[model samples]
Target: MDSIRLKIDSRADQVALAGRCIHALSKVVVGERAAFEIELAACEVINNVIEHAYECREGNDILIEWIHRDGELQIDVHDWGRAVPADVLFSPLPDIDHGDVTNLPEGGFGIGLLNALSDRVEYRTDEDEGRNTLSLFRRFDAAGISR
Candidate 1:
């Protein structure tokens, strides 16, 4: 599989650069629709890492990789700042009271959105090593299916 890799310091300022690259690459293989989906998911994952993974610390780093081959696209996001417990990061998002916009939650949609938009979503973490890996996959060929 041919892949493109990007390494960024875990800072908010660098996210835009990563997003542009991911969008451009996805656009080439799956066109704008798939690419936009990828962008949304990628942004959520990156933001979560920056805000939570390195929480209460500074100078962490993360790497994003795009693997494309045989009509499949896999995104692997890795970080070494802090390991998120599977129960927290992999669980489904809690239902919010949307009827009352005044009481709406400020967060809690990252994993669910990612799962809803990708064919597969998997997360692994090792708290002792302060490492986490999130893998998202999708098929973009003629048989491609929407999330």
Candidate 2:
């Protein structure tokens, strides 16, 4: 398997750059739609690291690894800041069935959307080492699957 690793400041502005890198890499194997899906999921993951893990701090580092092997793509987002809450990883989807768009919740969709876009999601955190990794996985071939 081949991998591309990127390390960037945990800033909101850098999320787009990371997303673009993910999109470009995924496009080669999964085409546009699936690539976009992967990119969006990745951006959400990065944003959560910034907003929650780093508490919106600017100087922390977030490392993203894009790995492709055996017809699968795995995106690993690593952070050395605050460890993610154990329960957040398995949180259920947001309750958007209010039948009123204006009454919808503004937040709480990050993990859900990440889960929906990728075939699998894994979260690992080691407080002793001050490391957290959020891995998003998807299976694809040359022709990719549609959403």
Candidate 3:
């Protein structure tokens, strides 16, 4: 198994760094396409933590951790900001297919995107601990095709 933990400030500029690091680490364990997918998912989670949880505030702590074993990858993102509403966190994916293209939202689609990109997604918050975690899981075959 391979694992790493990363900590960064809740700032927009730091997102790019996290993306790059995630991509590089994932590429080593999976194919380029799979790595890119993980990178995108991680970025979306981080952005949500910053914008929604931290309200775009800087200097707040965001922690990311990745673990790979048995051709499965698990990524966890933790933040010490506001807890996400259960309704929003567990909502079903938006039905964008039936909507008008122009009427579509430019953002607020991260949850759906994350669900589409990963094999599994989970979100948890502990009020007493003041921590929220978002976890993503993906599996790959020997050929590096995501399953």
Candidate 4:
């Protein structure tokens, strides 16, 4: 199948719309678990871009694309905002404490979840062009092994 691509504003609503498109495609091929994983990862990745890189700025366009090849589904997120520091982009993931409500942090888990849910996660920045692209992937067969 041909890859699907979208160019959306760097706003929460538009980002969510982009994510919904991925969710719809995932649900049809993968099971509910994998579908949700893909959907959540998509949202988290964009949220990080919005919060950190774009600084919640509006009007900027974010590029999102979905491609399925060789039993793998790939999602690419591109942004023209300020380049994120490599340390922040590749930091170690934090642990989640779901059982303890009081100990739960308000944020800081998005990156970890993005890395965990997707089979592979990569970030590349075009220094001269001042652009960044995040690539996420999910591998599945008939049973849909997204996790």
Candidate 5:
């Protein structure tokens, strides 16, 4: 098992960090396709924190950790931000109305994608501490590849 921790400042930095992690893990985990899926999933979660958690506030820190063990991948993302609303947390994707391009919102897609890509997704928030934690998990096969 291996673990790495990083503190990211900006959205671009977060994406870069995700890319780096993916590159490092890919060496150990086989199958480029599965690796790319995991990397994309991580990017969506990290970007969510960068855009919504801090609301573009400067100096807000996001902590990202990756854990690999027993043919499984675990990613933890932590941030200090306003507590996410319970409704928003569990809300289903909105149905497309007439497929109008302009009517569609740019946001909410990330959360939807995260839920779809990862095998497991969990969230924890402490209002008093203003902490939000997102945990993602994907189980891999003996070949170090996910299904």
Candidate 6:
């Protein structure tokens, strides 16, 4: 078990860093299913930061950390951007009418996907400092079953 840290800038770099993390973690994960689940969850989270945190600004930086401990993988994403409202952040999934493609929104599904994929999701923010921290954790046993 090890810890990996990355400083990501730019949307492209965020995706690249996520891919690298997934590749590295795959080597230690017990099964393909767990690895893929974590990778997909991370992808959605980082993409949300790129799209909403800094509003696609080019210079903003995101700190990503992955820790493997006690047969669990934990991810922490830190950003210095406008703080998202707690109410909206924890709100239930939006009601999407399948036929309304014209009015369909581009975002809001990342958090939902992350929640479904990860065993645990936590968030913290400091409005004055404009910093947001999101953490996700998933546990895998030696048998490759999620605990």
Per-model TM values vs. the true structure: 0.85, 0.91, 0.90, 0.87, 0.81, 0.79
lDDT (Cα, tens digit) per residue for candidate 5, span 37-86: 77777787777777777776768888888888887888888899765665
Off by over 4 Å in 4: 91-93, 96-103
Leading candidate by TM-score: 2
Clashing pairs in 4: none
Per-residue alpha-carbon lDDT of candidate 2 for residues 1-147, written as tens digits (9 for 90 to 100): 999999999889999999999999989888898999999999989999999889999999899999998779999999998888768876666888677989898988888888889898999887788899999999976456544
Q: What TM-score does model 4 achieve against the real structure?
A: 0.87
Candidate 6: C-alpha RMSD after superposition: 2.9
Candidate 1 lDDT (Cα, 0 to 1): 0.81
TM-score (C-alpha, index-matched) for candidate 5? 0.81
Off-target runs (Cα >4 Å) in candidate 6 are 91-107, 126-130
Kindly list the per-residue Cα lDDT of model 3 for residues 75-128, writing each as its tens digit: 999999998886675455566754588777676678777877899888999889
Q: Where does the lowest 10-residue lDDT sum fall in candidate 3?
A: 90-99
Q: Tell how far residue 2 is off in model 1, in angstroms.
A: 1.2
- Clash totals for all models, in order? 0, 0, 0, 0, 0, 0
lDDT of 6 at 2: 78
**Cand. 4 Cα-lDDT:** 0.83
Expressed as tens digits, the lDDT of each residue in 1-147 for candidate 1 is: 789999988888888888889989988888888898898888788888898888735577789999987878888899986667676756566588779998786778887787778888889876777678898888865655333
lDDT over C-alpha atoms for residue 100 of model 6: 96
